[model samples]
Target: MSLRQTVAKYFTNHAETRERHDDPALVSHYYKTTKDKAMAKLEEMFSDQQLYDLNAISKEHGEISVYTKKGRKVFIIVTVIMVRPFQTAIDFSVTSESALPFDFGHSNKIIQQLYAQIDQHFTPLDRN
Candidate 1:
């Protein structure tokens, strides 16, 4: 494995990171969707995986307090906002539940996968 992978494997216990994306097409869709509806959609997206302690903080923010299936507990916060007409931004904050200093890149992977899934399902607007 590479040096980065080695350190991630040996020295990390938890990880945290954030991602931001702008989706012009999703503004109206998100505005029309309720927080409960969004949370349900997220739950459905991860239905095949294990999740727990999921909560929607508001129409614009949601949190997942625990994810146990991955061996380490993970906490995730998702925020959605409308920046302008037909423009929406989504942000995600993910943190691992371990006491150790390293997270083995787990949190990064989670955010990547989430963005991939959301992009695939929702289809962002083309930049051109």
Candidate 2:
């Protein structure tokens, strides 16, 4: 399948529901409304080039990968950053964990940390 199709499917599959999951829509909504705003004020955000390097691939959106970590399949998704400084959202999920049994806390944390890491990597460019 094409990248766009893949991304769309992924988002649809993980769409938020009343039940609980790594709903991409819900997560995106939260980021766009809150995180995106806070990030906008920062002198440096994530640039598209940086995102591609971090993800180790070329794509306009994000990439999702699943791996076995400590005997559990962890879903690791790396999203491209459309902003400026060098930020990308990295999300992950493990079917075994339960602290956030109702939602995607772990994944969100990973994604946030990834963004911070990327943000730190870049030397802020002038804002003129």
How close is each model in CA RMSD to the real structure?
6.8, 12.7
Query: How would you encode candidate 1's per-residue C-alpha lDDT over 1-128 as one tens digit per residue?
Result: 56665565446553333232232211222333444555556666665555545544454355434354556677776665544554544556666777777676676676667767776655464332
Q: Model 2, residue 101: what's the lDDT?
A: 36
User: Candidate 2 — which pairs collide?
Assistant: 45-84, 45-85, 45-86, 46-84, 46-85, 46-86, 46-87, 47-86, 90-111
- Model 2 scores worst on lDDT over the 10 consecutive residues at 11-20
Native RMSD of candidate 2 (Å)? 12.7
lDDT of 2 by residue, 78-120 (tens): 3334333342233333222334333334434444454455446
Instruction: Provide the global lDDT of candidate 1 against the true structure.
Output: 0.54
- How far does residue 59 in candidate 1 sit from its true spot (Å)? 1.1
Residue 53, model 1: lDDT of 51
Q: Where is model 1 poorest over a 10-residue stretch in terms of lDDT?
A: 20-29
Off by over 4 Å in 1: 1-40, 43-49, 60-70, 126-128
What TM-score would each prediction reach against the true structure? 0.57, 0.31
